[model samples]
Target chain A: MKRRTRKAFISLIIAIAAFAILAIELYPIAITVINGFRRDIVILSGQPFKLSQLTLRSYQMVLKNIGFQLGMKNSIIIGLLSTGISVLIGAMASYGIARFRFSWRNGLAYSFLVFRMLPQISLVIALYLMFSYVGIRDTIGGITLAHTSFNVPYVIWLLLPFFTAVDKAYEEAAMVDGCNRYGVFFRIFLPIVAPGLVVAAVFAFLNSWNEFLYALILTGVNAKTAPIAINGLLGGETLTWGQACAAGTLMLVPVFFFTLGMQKFLIRGITAGGVKG
Target chain B: MSSRKPDTDGVSVSLIKGKARHRAPFLFLLPALLVVFAVLIFPIVFSFFVSGFNWPLSEGAGTRKFVGLGNYLALSVDPEFWNSLKLQLGFIFIAIPIELLFGFAAALLLNREFFGARLVRSLLLLPVFFLPILSGMTWRFMLQPRYGPLNALLLKLGAPEITWLGRPVTAYAAIIVQDIWRMWPFMFMLLYAGLTSIPQELNEAAEIDGAGFWLKLRSITIPMLTPTIMTAVLLRIIDALRVFSEVYVMTEGGPGSSTTLFSLYTHRQAFGYQKVGMASAMAIFLLCISIAFALTLVRKNMSLDSLEEKAGGG
Candidate 1:
């Protein structure tokens, strides 16, 4: 009887805790998702949870917004461009650090580490002023350039483990198997560490994709990301939760896919810091 | 394996191979370096130069009036600047230790092999991927005094619905709660990851010696996790120092500047008040704090790995 009572008490506590967690997280998501389908938030203000009060109108309106579409295109283009450049550089840098000895290797690696420490928020204003001065402020190329500064260091750090763990013999075996350096790297080393490269690329893409502070300061209509565009519009009376929710959900799509069924890999990449990649 | 050792007959082969190896890396690094230099590094140096002169990005404001350390001097005397620094320090003081403690508690609970462990761990990661601005806005909606579910629940439970972000202490308290909620996941993630890496053999040995749960945890679990704890704590410290996006999204340094952190102060100085020189000085100070903490972490991480290797070899 005593043991049964103890189990009941524990289970009750667990249930309560679980409910609270759901209230904090899923409740907001639920509210937002429901509103995303509502024609206007005023209808929901009367009855917030009625399924009959829904419409696809907000999503339609949001999709029709040229700013949203353009922001989406720019994000994808910049994210892909930045990721590709950063990954290629990251692979090489990590390879260099892991496989070779140089006098200033530590210095080079340390420089990259500093970039991770210095998130965009720290130098955002500085970058804004400088970029605007140089006449590159509202261009996609300018955003990409700004992204590469942070992305390169991130890629190098992320890819370091896979490069280090990859046995040198793979390249040697390829070399002795009658291939030159480029041939060995492409044919052997690259394939062996493909997952690490993917991890680095994904992180770079995500960072650039969802980055907002710089986008807010640097870009107006010319280079705004979805987050900035969405947040800018979420204001004042008629702060239609429906419209904001629709935009927010749309912004979440790419990130969702990127994180989908890959939390373990993503988690490993971050905490492992490629130490165990 | 044909003469694979670097120290044996492979010395010259290794030297040539090593030198040749770096060729690929340098080539690989070139594009990234060029882009980074143009965008990031140049701006850092350029910003330093601009900080000394009273200039805005826009040309119509003024031709660069050289102020010669006036910004630094002004920043030191700015009451708002000092208040902002105090706020950031307070956040660091209040946020980090709470996060660590709460995170450690959650990690300890989750570390046990429970039925729903994977689900629980994933639940923790949800906030990590959440955009900071989104996090603030979402929490703001929840804590709204009138129609907010939080208040609704409070009223139902017989407690008066307290305005969380309307007043000073409660407003700052809201930030603390939000920050802790968003950040505890990180500490848990790191500590949990670190906890698993600790060999079970140590635990078994401790068990053989009759250590209870508390004793085993107090001795075995903690010491091993210290380095990782430091790493996570340092990351949090650096991050907390630059707390801007969330606060901006939530309050915009509001309630008469009650929530203004250092970065917010810098933003207000440069943009709101047009104190470019003073803003730059504050930026430099923020840079110093970040650098001091980050450098210590990086240095410690390098030494820890080396020490681990030495211990492994011995």
Candidate 2:
């Protein structure tokens, strides 16, 4: 009877703990999602927990908003381009670092991390001036470049382990079978490292898509990202919570799927990849 | 013995040639490096050079003055600079412990077998992954005194509503709560991973020796999990020192400069006030603080580094 009582008490603590943590996380999400669909902001915020009244007016408003659509497109375009370029570059770099003993390898890798640790805003002001001078202002490519610089190091450092995990004997066997280097890589190596590459690509994509700072300073209309556009929904004059929540709801869909794909690789976290600088 | 070693010089040279031929893979790394250099490296070097000038970030470079060490010298006397430093520490002290406590507790709760374990685990990470501005902006709405849900919930529970972000103390408090929501999951995840790796033998032995759950947790789990816990804490402290996106989107360090973390302060100084020289010095100072903590923490937590060394074969 005492053992059973102890089990019940432990069960009760677990339930309460789980419920509390989940409530802390989910309360904001629940309110936003429910209220995002409502016709009136005043009604939702006033009675945020109520499930009786529901509407779809906010989504309709957000969809029709020009700035919202442009911001969404810019985020998607930047995310795709940056992820593609970064994963390719990172794959090659990590493969090189993993498979070979190049002379400048350690030095270059360390510098990449140093770049990662530096503040993002530290470079934003300088990039703004240069981008304007080079006639790249408000362009998706310029913002994409900034985002890529920050994310590629994360990808390379992350994807290196996957490359090294493939046995070197596979390459050696291909060499004996008269397959050239390119042929061996394609026929053997790429297939082996496929999951890691996908995970890396998704992670890079998510980081770029959710990026706010460089996108904030560098772009006005042409390249304004979702986060910036969401911020602008408030305007400086007043806080438009309803419209802002609607916009935030739209921005979150891609990120949700993006993370679902990338969470496995992040299980070890990034710092475990190789030598610490 | 000579016959057993039957490799000709030609075959060995060709083998050397095969190893040399893999330069094609390294060539694939160029496009990335070029983009990084153009955007990031060039800008950093340009910022340093611009720091040497009295030239404005805007139009023509007129009345340019050479000012070496003048920018850094001013950091010594800058009150806003010092307040920003103090405020950054204030954030670290306030955010780190709360997040650690909540994070570890949540990890322990979720680690045990439960009815909704998988669902709970995923839901727990949701706040951590929310876009920074969206999370801050949501809290803004939630803190609205009359219409906000938080206020409504407080009143429903028979408590008076406080103006959350309208004041300095409450504003920092709300920001810290938002930060803990977003950050604790990271620490919890790390600690959970650390928890799973603990050998069951240790816990079993403790139980057999008449140690209760509390005693086992205190003696075995906490002690063994130190390296992971410390690493998570250090990472969080460094991250909080650079806190910007949430603070910028939330309060923008106001109710009169209450939330001006070092990063946001440097940005405001450099761009808002256009003190490029002073901002660079400020950046260097914050950078020193981050690196100093990082070095000290790593020196103390050599076990985590040793684990990485073993894994990476360094």
Question: When superposed on Cα atoms, how far off is each prediction in RMSD?
Answer: 4.6, 5.6
Q: In order, what DockQ does each candidate have?
A: 0.34, 0.42
**How high is the lDDT of residue A8 in model 1?**
74
- Model 1 docking grade: acceptable
Number of clashing residue pairs, candidate 2: 0
* Cα lDDT, model 2, residue B159: 95
Worst 10 residues of 2 chain A by lDDT: A268-277
- lDDT by residue (B147-180, candidate 2, tens digit) is 7888888888889988899998899788888897
lDDT of 2 by residue, A123-207 (tens): 7767777888898879988888888887887787777666756766678777788886667767877888998888888777877
lDDT value for candidate 2? 0.73
Question: What's candidate 2's DockQ score?
Answer: 0.42
lDDT of 1 at B52: 90
Model 1's C-alpha root-mean-square deviation from the true structure amounts to 4.6
Give me the overall lDDT of model 1: 0.72
lDDT of 1 by residue, A1-277 (tens): 9998998777666655644654564555566566677766443343444567568888888888788888878888888998887788777766666655544566666666765677465576678777766898889877877787778877777767566666666787676777866676677888999988887888888888768777777788888777776676565566666677788777667666777557767665454341222
